[model samples]
Target: MNSFEQLKEEAVRLDAADTLAPMRGEYLFPQHDGKDVLYFTGNSLGLQPKGVKQALLQECDDWARFGVEGHMLAERPWLSYHEQFAAPSARLVGALPHEVVVMNQLTVNLHLLLTTFYRPAGKRNKILFEQKPFPSDQYAFESHAQLHGLDPAEVLVELPYSEGRTYHTTEDIERAIEGMGDELALVCFGGVNYFTGQLFDMQRITAAAHAVGAYAGFDLAHAAGNALLHLHDWKVDFACWCSYKYLNSGPGGVSGIYIYEEHTRNASLPRLAGWWGHDKASRFQMKNGFVPIPTAESWQLSNAPIMSMAVHRVALDLFDRVGMAALRAKSEQLTDFLQRVLMTVRTETGWALEVLTPSDPAARGCQLSVVLPGKDRSFVKVLAEAGVVVDWREPNVIRLAPVPMYNRFMDVLELGQLLARFAE
Candidate 1:
């Protein structure tokens, strides 16, 4: 067994060795009981970047200074606020700015994308998703299917892993596509499963969906910013993501959506319309007809929320400055170190604390989903009391995300020790 003092000493050494250690000061880490909490919940809610406060304050000051004219006169010009976030946001997802837009919430964006992509006909009407999809997504898909006069059970197909594991492999997903054949209207799943942190093969999945004559989409709420994505190059039909997690855009920040360039100019593509989606030139013309914008902007359902947009802008700026490659490098090393240390604990205690996340770093992200032997809830509470802030999902999983931008290597070390001590 690793000595408690030895673990603490090793944590200090790892912290000293971390190349990204200095960046931890850029975020506000929570403290409790006179100890800094080992925060591992970035997959649920990211630690706030220090700059977010100044960004939000700038908006408040703009509102105070310009009042009604803030839309045009504010420092950042609220009218073009969403556009300011586009470049960095596009880079984060490997898309052209015109292919991406920030608007609405995650589920709302999903519904809107479904409106454009889920065209059910006589045979090609089913939407296939992974079994145990996030509850919100399951609800959205079911409700959307019902709206088109199709029974949810008949139109919504959930593909479970043949091996009965926490994650569904690419082979299993591709088989589902082949089985569904021409009947599938859309194949959408989480880019990274929220419960297992399993990063699906987007390129392969998209190809399979297209081969089967189905639309390909991804819910990236847990994947965006946590993992590197090339959505446009992958020829994904559409994708939606919330910015509050690894994007560090604060709670309820603006979500992003991507529509492939092929779909961008397709005037025939059906979408639920709104004034904000009209072409900018004709938006205020107050004309009777809705002239959709030529780009992904056409998907917007309402005017931009400048407050949320400001937060997004700050987060994107940070990403642009730090760059994804550098963050991902640290992410791989940090998570690898974490898994190694945690495995040691499992070996010492003979605990069935298997990591649900894939062992291959390329097939996962910074998040590690630890599956405990018994009542995971009690284990979660013990970790909580030990000053670790990991999150618990139902059944037996506890997710701990060591976000690269702000989480220190020592944080991961502390987490492993805390859990090991709890098990003892």
Candidate 2:
């Protein structure tokens, strides 16, 4: 590793030794120019596994065959379809089965969770979050503040990194919470930053917020399958994630939420409820009294979208087979390999392509955010023309995520070669 080589032979050798390499075959890679495109955008949207179509078709067939009776008679029982995700989704985020539920989209769940947790009182009414949060989260934070009759400018605390730095240090976040003190109503952050790919210290941040009697939550849109999480052990107040990224459940896939055990079992906790959240025992009794389930499902506003959940079930099955620990191990190596590849290109091109994401493995996942400030932004177009699927941020940054799920070491090598040639 010290004498990192840029040869294709070396990449092939590395891939040969990667224990999780064979799992790549499980996914369906899109063809480009008579070959598979080198996909490095799992952080944006993951490639679909081959199993998804069959699972979706099975759900459709059952729905057609059983009419209304599929709720109880068909495979996986439509009435309790959301229950199937509890255990596997819990494992993905390190929560107990009762603590997790798959329902609604990411932003909707965020609003629902905020309504329950972000109860602002006089003085202790501020919401603290990252400065550059994903646009949806930023909107949710501001809207929730407005709903509570609090001015966002006055009550929303945006945590910024030190000057000239790209990401907030764990100490910066912890200190920011301490600085907010009694005024911090909630501490919300994207578990893995969408742009920087910097993994925040969720557990420490939760502990710091709790010390000041503030709620701690996360929008885990990028963190869900991209990083190893122990939300239950971390004692995080609540969290939510979409399954379309690293989980690979297709575009606009169903999202999931996790409520801490303390909150789930607490009947006193107030939440906006609906028929789906009503207790199953007396659900059909024609009773008016709303009885919320003593679990995360209590937040459900509607029934499960069976088709979306069916595809999600297939993705979760893969997670169960290939554990998060194994995935994280490969992810670190894959990302590190990419960093080296990019560095080699930088050396060859004499261009200052800076990686803004943290170098420490503990502080990141599979993504590497490369900033090409003075270079031609057209390099992204060139990479795209060459059939490498990566993402670009405005003002010049190309985000490449070498997903451990399907990306190969050879892909990284080829990308470096492409960049080196493009520079010429």
Candidate 3:
């Protein structure tokens, strides 16, 4: 058999033996030419769970039946709706239940967490973050510095990668944090970089920041469902992630946050409060003082968006049933197979492709960011037309994520064949 045929046979064998292979049937894939497209963009937006529609319809039925009384009388009472997510979300991120809370969108939650943790005092007034984080995080950091009447240019420190490298080394990150010393008020990073798909060492980074007397946090937009996290054990001060990406909630889905339990228990900590964050027993008393709930729920500024959260609940439940350990094991193998396929394409086609994501499996997630020299949106469009779905970042990067929850080994093999056929 030819090399391509051998690869195809290998993929078929792998698929047949995969324990998680049955999960691919649970999602609704985009159709192209009367077949499921080779989808590899779960890092951007996950496939819709088949149960989402029924879940939303159930919520609608509850609303139609109960009107305002639905807050208490619905099948899943709207009054305590957000509570349902606590344990599952905590499990997803390796945090205590009290440290996790489903709340506003990703950026909004980051701002709220910053209000409590980014306290600039005396010499410690600067915020340190890795370079090229998601743009929203950069904006939040800048605005927070401005809010504190400090110049962002000085108060925000963007840690650059080591010379001639596309990603940061853990050692370099730790050295930079140490260099910042007392000037660093907070060290925040995207747990996995959105553009490069590089996973930072959250535990080591958190420890480095603490040694320098700075609070540590992360924007887990690309890392939440994509990487294995342990925020509580890592002693991470705060984190926030949107549910729409790898979590498989729909677009503009509800976001969740993790605040270390110690911070959650600090009643005197400053926050932008709302009625929903008040003590449950006395919340309806319409009291003036804000008595923050002694959990991460204290940061919430409004009631849960039940409709959006209903979708989130379904996605989180799936994670609970499958568990991160099982998902991560599959993720590592799938991503590794994708890398080998890309290597084969380069060898056969002689295409000058560079994978910008880390070669080390532990330093990255399922997403692989490839730089195809001279290829642009036109190439991406061609691939899309040919029944392969992927994400294109600006400049010349094409990001592919073979999500373990739904993607198959054959999908990776076919993608390799397509690249070899299309490359000039």
Candidate 3 to truth, TM: 0.98
Kindly list the per-residue Cα lDDT of model 1 for residues 162-261, writing each as its tens digit: 7657678888899989999999999999999888898989999999999989999999998899888999999999999999999888888889999999
Q: In order, how many clashes per candidate?
A: 0, 0, 0
Each candidate's TM vs. the true structure?
0.95, 0.97, 0.98
Could you give me the TM-score of model 2 versus the true structure? 0.97
- Model-by-model lDDT, in order? 0.86, 0.90, 0.92
Between candidates 1 and 2, the one scoring higher on lDDT is 2
Scored by lDDT, the top model is 3
Per-residue lDDT for 330 in model 1? 83
Query: Mind giving the per-residue lDDT tens digits that candidate 2 earns over 310-417?
Result: 889998898889999999998998888888888888876777789999999999989999887565667777788889888889788889899988888899888878
State which candidate, 1 or 3, has the greater TM-score.
Answer: 3
Candidate 3 ranges with C-alpha deviation above 4 Å: none
Q: Give the Cα error of residue 41 in candidate 1, in Å.
A: 0.2
- lDDT tens readout by residue for model 3, 267-312: 9999999998999999999979999999999898898899999999
